[model samples]
Target: MTMPFRLTVLSLAVAATLAGCNRDKADETTPPPAASAGTGAVVTPADAAAPMAFESKTAFAEVSLTLPVAIKAQPDLHARLYAAAVRDLREFSEGAQADRTEAGGDEGLGAYDKSIEITPGAETGKLFSLVRTDSEYTGGAHPNSSFAAILWDKALKREVAAADLFTRTGDLSALDIALCAAINAEKKKRDPQAETVSLTGSDMWKCPRAALVPFVLAQGTRPGKAGGLVFLIGPYLVGPYVEGSYEVTVPQSAFRSLLAPAYADEFAGEPKPEHAGA
Candidate 1:
């Protein structure tokens, strides 16, 4: 009985192989690869998930000041102000990168990989950004978008204030570390008992998809010499992991000469003009 059953199985296998061979020979045409369901795009997941990394090792020149001799004479204050500006810009850009990572920004090249620069001018500041400009929608909307865009400032002091976010350390880049720390601090301030918000979604705690960090410093007048002002900087993230935000403050006082106006906006929803390139 066992031998008969084995023979029957072998015969069936041979018949199936012969049938497949016959079908292949009968097919005179080969179909093209199927397009994406919604996009009709031919690219595959491997094409979209390619790794991307950016770095700037060379430091751009110091920010050119538009202030008169009086403001320029205060070297210490000038240095501080310039440093603050660099720090703020670095933090802002890092937050942008983090947002992409949280949202799996690589879904499109336009939103994921980009560069933003800050240039100081005679009066106002300048911003420049370079990124993949392609965008497409599946709902039969705009297709085959712009290839690239060159955004520039019309009335700024310079083109962009340049700084180095890349560091030799293996850990997070300077900007990334600064943003993460700042956001962590802000959350602690809000809820002392909460845990470090991870990249998971939960009640009372969902991973924040959009987060921002703001740092503002100021100088004040003193009786004899200009005293240092306040040093306020913190980070906050908002997304699917967490609903609220967090902050960390490094409060200290320095000479008034060590102050410069650092303009950095820390909002989650607003689109930045840096990449817009007007």
Candidate 2:
């Protein structure tokens, strides 16, 4: 609900909101916010089903969220969506306000831009995910950035937890291991001479198991009927911040035994082994 990670620092937050982050890099890449679908696109009942809106008193941060416009819209649709949007905006407002406080007088506290989008892949809107990103520079030499994602089953009107995608909680444990292996493998392929990655140890290990659930949720854990459930890690989560966060998608077949009834039919699409490599 409140954002899953702090864009200001690199921590387990990528996996589930690490408590600490260091070094505010000047040129971190920020994902572009989603734009209006505009009035020109063909309209359908589904389109009318989920209407998105935003509110911002200043240019610092804005929230883009979906709400039910029809009287017959699902019972709690508007409430749920609005609640999610508000949570994000609150986090943004708090972060910006904190930066303003640091300004010593609240003047030109640098720029903070936070954006959100509900419908992705240009889908029919029946199934969508929330994509939120923030790029902020609060008087620092550079900016801090991070992206967070949470999938919503429009039809079900509930978040699709990482555990929800799999058959059981333990299945996620297996997935955590697979994800780490996949991420480290990605690091290796990108730079054969790159440092070894591990999330289990501090000094040299890449990440911690504690970050697994939160990281998965923040990564916008979503199911691909044709592919597999995908985990989009932000820059620096599993590697150096310079390396950037990335998607470590696995094939549906990789977890065929663990697929939930919802996505048990999926059988294609595995991220290219080298896809996450630089």
Candidate 3:
């Protein structure tokens, strides 16, 4: 069986690290390769580089990303704290009191099933959330999907709520664009044969259909680790900001909640297949 893309890569890289702890950190010093043909600028780092992986046991997908200096390698001010927040959220799912089931119609795909959303707020700190969702097939031959969301601090430390998190950090415009390009480059390497390229908003990329959307990178430190954080950079969709338009007109609040600690939750409940729509 094809393991979730993230978990498979995570296992390999974890094994590699355990087998040889002395290997140089990939993101610390090495320079990343040039940007794709026409996406954006490249990112490099200040320390030695190392290998990193993102995985999910239920998603049947795993992706390996470089820890090169540019984007993944930087030692942000809040990196350690952000990492802890991610770990906490992951733990929350295992012991959460509320496990509500919700479903709704989503574009591209019809309905999402067996989902739970959690919002966490801290006194004098940022806002963040944990969300877990699963998509199952009704008639079409699509494989089931499980996803988690997480938000971290500016330095990438403790996870915070969306309400407080953004206020504490700088505008993510440039960072968002740079991250999309980096992830796009990684996907290209993973599936060099993948055809077209489409970038929308900030981070989404149409690796196959040329559809683009906003994307973001979520980084957190490993549980009990000293100086490193796990980075999950991928395609994400967000509401576009229009000139002279009210921000409240869109679901920015909900989307932000889905982005961070939301990734830390668990979606291990057995999924129930439902009747498809006509």
Candidate 4:
């Protein structure tokens, strides 16, 4: 979490007093450090400057962005990632405003707004996760939001998707079946009120392999030795949006057989025992 930001546009000019508007207010300010060896223009927290902010407000809507401290630690990697996040936010905000304006500017629009918050997650060796959460309110019955947990291979400065963690078996039907049961089991285990539901052959059972890409990852024996891969599924993915978001954690064991050789050791779970017949 960084500093609280405010971006209000439209005729409403949403006053700053709006609830939960100014959340992260920056305190200490720092500057980018001198370039280091191979890091190029990257800077660590110590040398990184304060959050960069962008704001726009009109009678019809508002748009604002507070950049996370750019890393520049690995060439332009940090900056590039941050830029992508910012670009998404900008498009969400500005696009809505444009659409509304074309529709003759809703006479009763209340704070057509959008905001993004970035936070750091698990980091082991050169692998790290950057979690981005977006919350926005157009003229909807409720606010719309989303979360993306990106696992990055910092050493290589690229993103790691779920498929990359496994070997291409040409067919993932088995993996899909196992994950659905696992997700349903976890859900019921955590929720006392949840019914014992069989996800097999159900639409809910279709847990996209992509859904296993972790928002947060850590060491464990379940999903793999690398730990549990927790995929955050928003409303409508598993259930209606009003039902809220859901998390299905596929332990390393769930797909151990499919684990890529490169990732197998990292995601290895408990060792299988030798057969007594042997």
Among the numbered candidates, top lDDT falls to: 4
Query: Against the true structure, what is each candidate's TM-score?
Result: 0.21, 0.58, 0.27, 0.64
Q: Give the least accurate 10-residue stretch of model 2, judged by summed lDDT.
A: 213-222
Best by TM-score: 4
lDDT assessment of candidate 1: 0.31
**What is candidate 1's TM-score against the reference?**
0.21
Measured over all alpha carbons after superposition, the RMSD of each candidate to the real structure, in angstroms, is 25.6, 17.8, 21.7, 15.3
Of 2 and 4, the candidate ranking higher by lDDT: 4
What's the lDDT for residue 59 in model 4?
60
lDDT of each: 0.31, 0.51, 0.29, 0.56
- Sequence-dependent TM-score of model 2: 0.58
- Deviation of model 1 at 262, angstroms: 16
Off by over 4 Å in 2: 1-83, 94-104, 107-111, 117-130, 169-173, 202-224, 266-278
Q: Which sections of candidate 3 miss by over 4 Å? A: 1-133, 144-146, 150-159, 168-170, 195-278
Q: How many residue pairs clash in each candidate at the backbone level?
A: 35, 13, 64, 30
The sequence of per-residue lDDT tens digits that candidate 1 reaches over residues 1-278 is 01245877787777677767888575433334655637765644333222122233212211111222322322333343345434543554465566557766546444222232222211112222222222222223223222221222223322222121112232323333333444455556566765665444354443332112222211112222111111122112332223322222221221111222232211112112221110
Q: Write the per-residue lDDT of candidate 2 for residues 172-208, one digit (tens) a residue.
A: 5555566667677777777888776665657634643
- Greater TM-score among 1 and 4 belongs to 4
Residue 61 of model 4 has an lDDT of: 59
Query: What order do you get sorting by lDDT, best first?
Result: 4, 2, 1, 3
Ranking by TM-score: 4, 2, 3, 1
